[model samples]
Target: MKELFKQIPSVDQILSKKEIKDLIDKFGYPLVKDSVRKSIEKVRDEIKSGKLKEKIPEMVFELIPLKVEEVIKPSLKKVINGTGIIIHTNLGRAVLPESVADYIKSLSTCYSNLEYDIEKGKRGHRDSHAERLLSTFFNVEAATVVNNNAAAVMLIINTFAEGKEVVVSRGELIEIGGSFRIPEIMKKAGAKLVEVGTTNKTHLEDYANAINENTGLVLKVHPSNYRITGFTKSVPAKDIAKLCKQKGVVFAEDMGSGNIYDLSELGINDEPTVKESVNAGIDLISFSGDKLLGCVQAGIIIGKKEYIGRIRKNHLLRALRVDKITYAAIEKHMELLLREKYHEIPVYNMIFKQAEAIRKEIEEFISGFKLENSELEIVETSSKIGGGTTPEREIGSFALTFNLNKSPEEIEQYFRSREIPVIGRIKGERFLIDFRTILKKDIPILKNYVSQLLSH
Candidate 1:
């Protein structure tokens, strides 16, 4: 054991090797040193456990470069979404348009009027960039934005209902990603959550009965990720707004995935639009920019100027505020919406793409591949609008099912090991690639990837 341990090269001796010197030239010395340290630690542990028994120098030299490569690899690389779930949260929801990306790049590299008003030549509000567009698009008096929808909800509660009672239905208290619950957020905001009615049914009278002098607001949360049926009845936004108006209290709603256009025309009826909520006379409403809106991640709040002004003044607003890059991206996204260019956005393009078009693309993709050991076939599959929106509805889509040489898990791991990882779904012992979420430009990359894999 002592002889084996003595063979292990010291850090200075290892750094003197040709391969280690080459690695130092490629990646800086610090990274190479860290990799060498890690490799040495791993070898020591293995030797102590009696697992390492051969030539030690050869093993250590061979392991150092691999460890260096692994250590230097980036964690946030882009991956192809072969999975049929659009706006998949795990895959980074809502791919932004090219224009938005270009704008973000430009804004990130250089300074802009983030807080300066060019026309006024003085200090201005950062929210002013998207406020006019949001006000015009949603037909609201004023608007503001935060980092995310959860922040928007928290800010609203802390701003208006802090140290006061905010009535909400037991059924509408939803838990979103990361185990973030509504009541917990309300408590964090220093607001008293007053639960009204039962989980299955909540009447307008229940809200009216809950209102009192200490009641600050009546909140109606949209159940974005789940649905209740068969015996569930909840108060409509109009009725809730009317009750709040009559009771002289604020009425607000947290629309998790805010839609701008009516999706019913595209056969999706359950997802309500922000336009409808604004028309219902609600005092304030909030929704997400990254989900159904197909933009960067933001929490957009739109409502009467009175309530929005108060929300802007809240101390938490500074902590939850978005940066200039977000403002630039959102402004460009809103410009597309204003121009009535729904198909230009990635999420809408995926949702509204015809099944026939997707089938054609898949056929073209398959025509280029000459498989030796794998069988590929096109099959009809259902694609979902993920990101906690429209849980029960699935859009009609087409997928390519690959009967490969390896097991489903092995093939999936092989694809994931590629430079730009290809994420797919496994069904009935086969790997599936749903073309609905894939962009047209990604076809060439996918083709090259498949060709390389087949050659191997």
Candidate 2:
């Protein structure tokens, strides 16, 4: 161990190496020096653990550049969604319409009327672009965009129920992705939580009993990630809205995975459209922009002007406001929706893509796809609208099933480590790359990766 420690090059010695000098030129001296120190530390650890069989300084020097590259490499990159999860939260939910890229780029490269009203040649609000578009789709008096749906929830709760009681159904208290619970958010917003109803059932009377003089809000949370099966009963949003109206209490809903598209024809029937909630007379409602909306990350707040106007005035809205890039992406997405070109939206495109259409594409790809060392076949599978929207609902889809001498885990890792990671799933001892979540253009890219994997 003493000899191995001595053999490991010092940070200075490693930085002086020709390979590392080139890295320093590329990434600068501080980053290369840091990487060299990390490489030397790793070497010492490996030697102490008996993982290093040889005490060679050349071996240490050889890895210093790799460490430098890893340090400088980006952690966020493009990934192929072959997992059949459309609104996949882990993979950046809501694939924006391809048409929005140029607009986002144009705004990013140059500044326009992000806050300036060009028509009046004076200062203006940035939310006007998307807020104007949101009004046309929903029967809402006002709207605003925040950083995310969670922030919107916090902002609204703090604005309305900070010093009062917030009534929520026991069954409707949802823990969304990342363990963000409704009760916890409400508490953080400084609202006293009063949970009504049982886990499986909550009635209008329970809500009625929970509301009183101190009740400032009745929050209805839609659990998008899971479903309650038989014997489950929950009160309708309309009834709650009416009750809140009668009591003069603010009624708001955290409608998880807010859907605007009418997907009943595509077999996605359980999730209600955002228009229904807007039309149902909810005073305030908040939802994710990147989930079902197929836009950038934003917390879209839409409802009656009486409440929305108050939320807009909250100083916290400034803290939770989105930037110009998000506004541009959202503005373009709404434009496409307004024009009735819903198919241009990636989420809708994937949802509306029939199983037969994907199978046909798979069949065409499989006809010429040859793997000398593996087996590939077209198989029936179900795609999920991930990102906590309709968790139990499955869409009919097809996948390219893979069977190789290597374990399914090994096969999965091979594709996941590619230049553009191809994320898939393992089930029934087979690895499947579902085409539902994959764009038609990406199939060829995947084919190339599979072919390259075969060579290895």
Candidate 3:
């Protein structure tokens, strides 16, 4: 290696335009000439520092070119959501329906009615598209949307209670997924947070005692990411609303991960519905469109027409307003929910799929995979409503478990890096392909990918 290094010229001689172009051709245009030029510059700097022992510079030239491609590539890309964690936050929570996608694509190329009232021939509200549908679906007097649930809370607090006290249960001051804690948001919104009780227990008295002349709002936040059990107490939205009404304070319920449908019929734990919260006579109720509602990234506020009107007039509403694409998608999703087209929403379909159908699908796929003397079994597994919803509920599911020649981790990584990633769980030293969340159409694509990987 030392003799080979001696025979090679200085670092400056190796990086010619032709050589760089050759490397560019090998790696696609994503890397190309810019990466090679930068790598060459790095090597020159390394040589000046007396770090080049011939082979080191060549190695540096080779390595830095590869690193540059990775450094410049966009962090966001499409990944198949096969982890069975529907609403997987890290993988872009809440996959929009095909109708929503088509609508977004249709409006992208042309001018839209986003801010124009066609009937009146005048400027219009951006929330007009989704507002009526949301109101009808949630049974509220009116509705408005912001970019996300966090922003929705911020807008409400800043609009109604900035520089005033907002009382909430200590248990309800929960941290949502992604470290977005409620207290932090309240502080940033310029509202003073008054904690009312212990983490596991909070009473209506806690809220009543916290209310005083300067208190502007009574906030009740749902602990979406976690649940407390065993000797626990909570104040219902109705009770809080009554208290707020008597005290002349604004009532707001942060219905985190609020779903419109009843999931107990689908064998999942019972979660509070948005309509129920609204019927509690609260001044305002806020929930996420992406989680249980199964829509786009939106913070939906539904309440008394007057309060929603105030929220709409807030200056921050402009900064947190949803765009045309979001309005289109949210409108379509709400329509589907109202029409009872439950199957159209992928998250609902995955969660509510029958266990028997999942087993049959797994059996059919297993029959196609001739394992070459390897043993495979369609074992019963459990699915979950991940993305920090329903932490304790496990749905019945089926999985295809096989003993592969490659290590389980290696096979898992292979699927992860494949063009269409197949994320599944590994159990008892075997990779388990859970079929509850896997769509029927995805089965063939998965089979082909596995066959290709095993063949190589």
Candidate 4:
């Protein structure tokens, strides 16, 4: 063991080797040195543990380049979304419109009026950029944006209901993704949560009864992720707004998905739109920009100018404000929405795409695959509107189910091992490919990947 340890080359000697020197030329000195050190340490440990059978120099030389490549690989590389969950949170919620990337690139190359007003030649508010667009689309008085939906909720609570009672129904107190409960958020924002009515039912009178001198705001939360159907009753937003008006308290709603247009036309009738909430006379409303809106992640707050003005003045607004990139993307997405270009946005396109279209795409994808032992067939599957929106509703979709010679787990692993990993679901001894979430451009890539795997 001592002789084997001594036989291991020094870091300097390893770096001087032709292969490692080539890596140094390609990557850099620091990375190559680190990789060599790690490889040497690993080989020494293995030798001590009696696991290293190869000669020390051969093992160290072989492992150095692999370690260097591993170290240089990016952590946030993009992956193909074969999973039919539109707005899949883990795979990055909403795929922004390609125009958004163009906008970002254009902005990246040059400076723009992110804050300064070009006409006035003076400092301007960043909120002014998207405020008018949001207000116009939603028919609200004014609008502002923050980092995300959670920040929107927190800002509203901290601004209006901090250190005061914010009335809400027990049923509307939902726990969003990652254990973020409504009650906990309220507490964090310095608001006293006043729960009214039972989980299954909360009437108008319950909200009216909860209002008192200490109450600063009446909050109505849209439970975006889950639905509690069958014999359930809750106070409508209009009624809640009316009650808050009578009580002389602020009425605010946290619409989780931030839907701009009515999805009911596409058969998703249950999800409400921002227009409806604004029409209901809710004084303040907040929603997500990334979910149903098909834009980058942002928390859009639109409401009466007086209330939005106050929210902008809150000290925490500075901490939760978005940067130029977000403002730019959102502005472009809003323009697309205004122009009625629904197909431009990926989320809307996926939701409204015909089942027949997806099936055709799948047929093309599977036609290129000549698997000796794998059988591919088109099967009917349902795609979900994920990212905590419309939990119960699933868009009708088509999938290519694969009955491979290998186990389902092995097939899944094989696709996952690709350069841009293919993420699909497995069910009942077969691997499934839901084509709704898979873009048309991704087909060639998928075909090449599958062909390569079969050839191997």
**Which regions of candidate 4 deviate over 4 angstroms?**
15-22, 369-374, 453-456
**Model 3 segments more than 4 A misplaced:** 1-33, 41-74
Judging by TM-score, tell me the better candidate of 2 and 4.
4
Alpha-carbon deviation at 225 in model 4, angstroms: 1.7
Candidate 3's residue-wise lDDT over 1-456, tens digit each?
A: 445345444434544546655765677555554565566666566666777656655565576557766766677776665566777788777777778788878887899989999999999888788888988887878889988889998888888889999998888888866789888999999999999989899998988889999897888887787899999999878888898899999999888787766778756655777878878898898888888787888898988898988887788888888888888888888888889888888888887888899888877776886677655678887787776677788888888776667787887888888777788777778787787767666777888886786577
For model 2, residues 8-100, the per-residue Cα lDDT tens digits are 766777667787788878889888788778778887778888888684686677677788778778999999999999988889888888889
Ranking by lDDT: 1, 4, 2, 3
Model 1 lDDT tens row, 1-456 = 777788889999999988899999999999999989888888888788999987888888888998988977888898999999988999989999998899899889888999999999999999999998888888889999999999999999999899999999999888878998999999999999999999999998899889999998888899978898889898889999988988899999999989765667557888888889998999999998999899989999999999999998998999999999899999988988988888789998888888999999998889887766547789998899898888998888899876657788887888888888999999888888899988888888888887776666
Worst 10 residues of 4 by lDDT: 367-376
In terms of lDDT, model 3 sits at 0.79
Model 1 Cα displacement at 222 (Å)?
0.9
If both were scored by lDDT, which would come out higher, candidate 3 or candidate 4? 4
Report the poorest 10 consecutive residues by lDDT, candidate 2: 366-375
For 1-456, candidate 4 gives per-residue lDDT tens digits of 788888899998887778777887899999889988999999998998999866888999889888987978889987888889998989989998998879888887788899999999999999999997888888889999999999999999999988899999999999978897999999999999999999999999998888999998899999978888898998889988887888899999999998766677557887888889899999999999889898999999999999999998899999999999999998888888888888889998898889999998888777776655646789998899898888887788999776656788988898888888999998787788798998878888888877775665
Candidate 2 runs further than 4 Å off: 1-19, 46-55, 370-374
True-structure lDDT of candidate 2: 0.86
Candidate 4: clashing pairs of residues: none
Name every residue pair that clashes in candidate 3.
none
